[model samples]
Target: MGLLDNVKSKLSPAKDKVSHLAQKHEDKIQHGLDRTAHAVDKKTKGKYSDRIQSGTGKAKHAMDRLAHKDDDGGSMSPPPAGGATPPPPAS
Candidate 1:
């Protein structure tokens, strides 16, 4: 394999491990994100409230994607509990 392919092969296991952890602790991860966002907003005294909220929303959306949860309330469902076939993407 080429250099990039070699690096990707070596990192595959680590990536899988991280993905599993993220899926397993998705709720806790989301909670931590919210808590941190709240703390930052408080510290900033609402000056950047809008920006903070936007960033927080983006972060939560990313976490949801990582956890394979559908964002749009469309027919697409969340990943099955057993980690079988993943759900389809929303339109």
Candidate 2:
């Protein structure tokens, strides 16, 4: 396999583990994200309120993806047909 494929293979197990954990503790994780965002917003006295809110929203969206919350039957869906490229994974 190529270097990128090799690296992805090695990380697959860890990714699966993280996905499982995220699914199991989704509520708690979301709550923690909200609490942290609130604390940071308060500490900054609303100077970075917009940015903080945006970041928190992004984070929650990522967590939902990791948990596969959008998937039906708790499994990943197949990629679309017509050779359309899938979106890159979230950073």
Candidate 3:
């Protein structure tokens, strides 16, 4: 396999584990993200409130995607329309 494929193969197991954990503790993870964002916003005295909020939203979205929350029954979602190959089916 090519270098990128080799690296991906090595990391796939870790990625699946992380996805499982994220699915299991999704609520806690989201709460932590919100709390951290609030603290950072407070520290900056709202100077970057908009940017902070945007980033928090993006993080939460990523977390949901990782957790497969957007898919039915927690199955993997289809690949994006950008012509990338989908991940292999979970064993």
Candidate 4:
């Protein structure tokens, strides 16, 4: 096997274990994501509430996909055709 393939083979077991652990802790992760976004909003004095919420939702969705990679790799569905694009990440 090529070097990259060999590396992937070695890492597959670790990846599976991580996915399993993430699935087991999914609820905790979701709660923590919510709490973190809420706290950030509070700290920002609600100035970025909408942005914070949107980002957090995306993150949770990504995590869900990661924890269930057999379905899809942590991807949020594409936004509606007419919907605004998500803002770029903060620098």
Candidate 5:
């Protein structure tokens, strides 16, 4: 295997672990995201409400994808169209 394939193979288990953890704590994660967004919005005095909401929605969608929880609560692969593009990590 090429270096890329080797790297992917090595990382596969870690990725699966992450997916499992994300699924197991899906609801708590969702709640945390919502609560965080609300707190930030409040701190900003609604100045960034739109952006905050958008980001929150994207985060929830991503968590759903990671948990293999689709709209119908059925397992699904990563979204075929946009894919599960995570946002840049916060500094």
Candidate 6:
């Protein structure tokens, strides 16, 4: 098997498990995201309110998609691009 295929096969079960968990605990996940965003906003003293709000919205949307996986248990929805908002974490 190709390298990608082999890795995918090995990780398939784990991925499915995560998808199931996400679906089951979607509310908890969203709450955590909100908490994180709130903490960051507090730390920044609202200086980046607009940017932070935009980023938090994107993050919540992405988490919502993950929590509602498709029939194949894969994430098919694409997240909203941040555009000029907070840049994504560097790889």
Best by TM-score: 2
RMSD of each: 11.1, 10.7, 12.3, 6.8, 8.2, 7.3
Local distance difference test values of all predictions, in order? 0.64, 0.71, 0.72, 0.71, 0.72, 0.70
Spell out the clash pairs found in candidate 2.
none
lDDT tens digits, residue span 1-91, model 3 = 8999999999989989998999999989988877787777777777777787777777776777788844666565553332211222233
lDDT of 1 by residue, 1-91 (tens): 7999999999988866776787899889877877777777777776776777667766666556655633454244443343221222222
User: lDDT tens string, model 2, 5-88?
Assistant: 999999989989999999999889988887788777777777777787777777776677778844765554443232221222
Worst 10-residue stretch by lDDT in candidate 1? 82-91
Q: Which residue pairs show collisions in model 4?
A: none
Worst 10 residues of 5 by lDDT: 82-91
Q: Which ten residues in a row have the lowest lDDT in candidate 6?
A: 82-91
State model 5's lDDT.
0.72
Residue 21 error, candidate 1, Å? 0.8
The backbone clash count of each candidate, in order, is: 0, 0, 0, 0, 0, 0
Q: Give the TM-score of candidate 6.
A: 0.69
Off by over 4 Å in 1: 69-91
Q: Cα lDDT of model 2 overall?
A: 0.71
Off-target runs (Cα >4 Å) in candidate 5 are: 69-91
Q: After TM-score superposition, what is the CA distance of residue 45 in candidate 3 from its true location, in Å?
A: 0.7
Candidate order by lDDT, decreasing, is 5, 3, 4, 2, 6, 1
Model 3 off-target regions past 4 Å?
A: 69-91
Give me the runs in candidate 2 sitting further than 4 Å from their true place.
Answer: 69-91
